[model samples]
Target: MNGPRHRIFSPITRAGRASGQRGAAVFVVMLVVTLLTGLGIFAVRSASLSTMASGFNRQLTQTHYVADYAVLAMVGELGLNAQVHSTNMTSGGSTQCVGFAELVAADKTPSCAQYGYGELNALAQTYSSQELLQPPTGTYPATVVPGSLGASPLEGDMRIEVTDWHPAWPILPGNDATKGQLGYAMVTVSAIGLVRPNPTGMAAGTWDTASATAAGVESSRAHVVLGPILMSN
Candidate 1:
């Protein structure tokens, strides 16, 4: 057998090879850290946006219910006073008249000066001012059914202001019908709702005094003009 041959070594030493491998590993680790950081930021931003949207949506929903409730309650309350009267004539005949809120004629209406809305709105405020007391004032006047509790996260109010009135109808012969006029009234209602972030004091978290102001709040409002209800004598 011929003499064993020795292999020549390259210029790069083992230490150099190990150092190169270590550098590559370091680069990979840095890349992974950067990617994780980006993902974390994205997650935080998405969560924040979602929270804001949720808050806004909650306010909108609450306001919608508030408006709907206000309208329905107003109508229901006025409906209770509705009346149907039949006047009998001397000739043994009769006429029917419905008494809802008072009726308003075209000529004698005035603007809603109380709420600062001018004549631009279809229904104008008339009749002398009466004290329409609302219990527990808030962003608006809401009639709370008996024993219902309110929460702080959402605050709201509803109010109905009567603006006009009309006399009852369908008179019998020689009957002074206007003396016992059924209710014919026009009204305007307002419903307002508000929501705000939980206060720092409300829960356990690291909170700064300045952060309390930064906490966001949202609000929603609805208004409607309601009309002529039949009132009883």
Candidate 2:
């Protein structure tokens, strides 16, 4: 009478199937959310690194420009080279009062042995950094030279050194020293950007007033740059 005992599924079974489907959908959504979160984190980190790099590059360029100015200033000073002191009949055996510019007019190049140049002595020569400190007193008079930059907030310190001078090399066609036209000289210019104040430079006697610079952000890093200068007409 039950027509071969045909079975019908109950609501509970249907309910079980629906729950399973919901669980799978939830798992897929959670996986997609996790992936999106990971991608977002990577993007943020990349942007942060790029910003830091940009700041570092900006600082570096600023310091470089300041160094370039130092070299250019030295060039101008050399352009106005002239006898500033008369090296008395000193140990070098010289008695003349000619400026560096005037030396270009001489038959031979002047002596700059003490400054790691040539050995031969001469009457007139460019002054060194230490020599520039004091006035012209003894035989070795202080010739005019490029000095340290005054106080500045942007840059820490700037200096230029006129290493040596010589007649234009190879004696270009019609190159005349007597006409105040000669080859170029080398100048070493440096610019320092300070991340931390110098204890010695600030206070000579103190030892532990401030800590040394520690590595952090490249944009906040200290820099020391030395640039060579070749000055001519």
- Could you tell me which 10 consecutive residues in candidate 1 have the lowest summed lDDT? 113-122
Question: What is the per-residue lDDT of model 2 for residues 1-233, given as tens digits with 9 covering 90 to 100?
Answer: 54677678899999999999999999999999999999999999999999989855655564555455444444444345422211211113221222334674665444321211111011123443232111212222243332232221121323333323333344445545443432333322222222223323442123343333321111121112111222233
Which tens-of-lDDT digit does each residue in 147-216 have in candidate 1?
Answer: 1113332223333332223342434346544644432333333322222233222321344455444333
Return the lDDT, model 2, position 2: 46
Q: Report every candidate's CA lDDT.
A: 0.39, 0.38
Candidate topping TM-score: 2
The TM-score of candidate 1 is 0.42
Question: Mind sharing the TM-score for model 2?
Answer: 0.43
